[model samples]
Target: MLDARREDLGRMLRAWRMARDPGLLPGPVPFRGHRSYLTQLDMALLLGVSERWYRALERGEDRTYAREMIAGVVRILDLSPRQATALYRGTGHQPPRHRAGGARPDAALLDLLHQQRRVSWICDQAWDVVAANTVAARHCPWLMHPETNTMTWAFSAEARYQLREWDTKWAVPLLGQLRLAWQRWPDNERLDEVVRTVRREPGVAELWEDTTGVRGDADDAARPMYFPLVAPDPLDVRVATYGRFGDTALRWVVLSPVDPSVVFP
Candidate 1:
């Protein structure tokens, strides 16, 4: 049964790694076009570990795989947050279900959460906000504060606190990313519900019809905009966001200030 599970996991990793294109990685695109296949050695190099060590990993040997090492493999394979979490479990370190208090967030992740000090949250592979700090609660106010999903917050009026710029140019690409997520995970019921909710919310319906594509790049005209704090005067909270996707399904997002002066003390 154990070997069978290992083989199954190995197969999953292989499939996810194969599906990605060269454009997804850093450095210039390889010459002679590009190849889809990746050897165990290639994966090892991508993870910055020894070939022998990774070989053992592929064979399903337990042998102390560091969280970062496993995380690196997850990123290389481009696993969704859910997939990454599953893969993490398949390693045999994590439990299948939570204990009474539930699993604790890793120390590094917790540190990252506290550092942002803004309205930030982490989205699991299933597109659910698995973890969110108080700032996110204040800004988003889960109690009927417009749209629930991050995309909705980017496009809806309740999202007004997040959007300083008032143009479709800014809203369209973000919408497109959400659209891509819809295409990527049709089975994600939460995302499906979010789509339905946003679709009915006043102005969002119009933007959904005319989405261009995901546009968070530096060159995009929809640059960073500051959402003013209704409570305080002269404090413009300019949010700068960052994202890191694992080879597995998880994606971590950090929202912070464009400048130190904009942060709310």
Candidate 2:
């Protein structure tokens, strides 16, 4: 039974690797002379493990594998939540809870965001912007940037200028949300990077350490917030968030105009 499971895992990993688009993966595009699929060496390097060890695992020779290594594989391969859970169980490690999150968003969620009449965006548990609708892109152009992350944006000098109530309302509550996510996904490297980046900002480190159990009330109260647009107009928008269906760790954030008469630019 153990051998069978290992073989199954090996096959599945190979299939996933083959199916992945090279352009979407990190590192150089022509990875090790293979444009379509990743070699064992490439996978090993990405996962920070030895090529021989990775090959051994693929051959079902390494029965004892670390959970962190498995997690790294999941991240590097961009595996779905379901696939990650299955890999964990097949390798004799207890799978993490369904909502263990990451940067990737589901296709259905992206489609929904695009179809929404109101401005909507999707983010991962780490608060990385995954997708945004046309209205959101038009109003908040920064959201369309390739490197935008919620925590990074909040602590930025640009945010200090654009966001109303940067210190009290924006930064404080955002830090609280980060804290809550940190508690839930302690080992998430992306979240770790966000925390590190936020701490470097002036006065943010103190707030992060001193503030305990701060959670965002946007979803609970459906409160409206003000966002300053580049066009010298401030929009009052109510925020609503939804979790992705199933065990995925993706969330959808929708912004509706508080005043019906106000039209988005």
Candidate 3:
């Protein structure tokens, strides 16, 4: 029983309002407030409408408003074109166009991956494997190791054994991270294709459907690894992940030695 218009408006308000910094917005600045101009009274004055009427519109009690009025409010709020359009659409007014973030992978990002000696890999908003060093490629070979990076391999076949841990503990956190990426890049075509391919794996599909968040319960037990090490295994490793923000994002995960004494897998 959520009102779509109210929800959309709330989302937009939250999104826009959170971006404002007190240092950036003018005024004597209340000690804690972020300085948003969209107070209920201000909204009423801007709309040239009664405070009660405006309150009703904000509370989802009113379903319609004048196009010009909505546009004026949109301008007063200083919304981006897309944000304004979303507001207009939510209010049953004609929206100009739909636009979403269009960020891409960067080749320069490989430098960041290469600098680290630990097991490392990079994935975009869709969890597309953009880059991976030799260490990550060696151990977690099932999904990311192949010529074509596929998420399906994580849940199927030998991965249950390959992960160095029992049960879905290893796979679940990875899937959760990928799920976060999917939420951000819902329209990525490659991601859609990857999701379709992963669905064929029953285990992956089940985990994907389960909404519970993944926690690293097995983190302590399952050490960072590279399967079948050479004779002089030099280090004890632990898995740690890092993220880099792009115009969109790319999750750059690096698995490193918790202590030097621990040997390679």
Candidate 4:
């Protein structure tokens, strides 16, 4: 079993290295020592480890590296959330805890966000805004705030002032989604704090108390909501959610405008 796991990890590491874009490499030098794509030497330099050590791991000759080393490799490779978790498990190590401070969108998700013309953002289990595209930030400036959080922003006075039909269109559905997140990550302290903070609002506590299931699945249809920041007109948008493969706590949210004519400044 151990040998099989090591071989599998080695295969995955090779695949990731081969698939990596040379442009993603840091610094002006794209490749290390005249190699195309990411070479073992480049990964070693990036991780501050010796080439032999990195090569050993890639060859499945050694599977005794520390967790921190594995983490460094994850960062250097720009591994997806799922890939990071898999790396931990395949190496006989427990996966790291999901927390606000450690939440980050992987390279693929970041690339997708940059390519999207529609409003899109990524959030963690705590609903903390980890990343957003230009369109999302431009249309919804609040999403770019340093302390942006979906639950807090939804219940804030600013949101109430900015959104039309805040109660039916935004607040209710948000509460349901928060309830789902809380259920999935009940022990996450940041989420606990978020729930406590939101429960202090006028009717939000009651709504949260009544919310029992997840209502924000990928298939959940979008509802109409007016953004005063854009204009007085209502923009119909669909909110689609996607879960990262191994990291169920991270979500990708895309707000696709129903009308193709709508464009953000």
Best by lDDT: 4
The per-residue C-alpha lDDT of model 4 at residue 224 equals: 73
Please report the candidate that would top TM-score against the real structure: 4
**TM-score rank order:** 4, 2, 3, 1
Better of 1 and 4 by lDDT: 4
Q: At residue 208, what lDDT does model 4 achieve?
A: 67
lDDT of 2 by residue, 1-265 (tens): 4377778788888888778764454222224454776788877776667998888777766468888788667755678888988888888889765443545655555566767777677777777776677677666666655435777887988777656666775777778777777777887877777778888999898887777756655444323344544234555566677885574477788877767776665
Of candidates 3 and 2, the better by TM-score: 2
Q: Against the hidden reference, what TM-scores do the models get?
A: 0.46, 0.57, 0.46, 0.59
| Selected candidate, larger TM-score, 1 vs 4 | 4
Best-to-worst order by lDDT is 4, 2, 1, 3
Q: What lDDT score belongs to each candidate, Candidate 1 first?
A: 0.55, 0.69, 0.54, 0.72
**lDDT: which is higher, 3 or 4?**
4
> 130-242, model 1: which lDDT tens digit per residue?
44554665555441121133655555675554455545445665666667766777876666766786677777777777665444342224244443443333233333444
Model 2 clash pairs are none
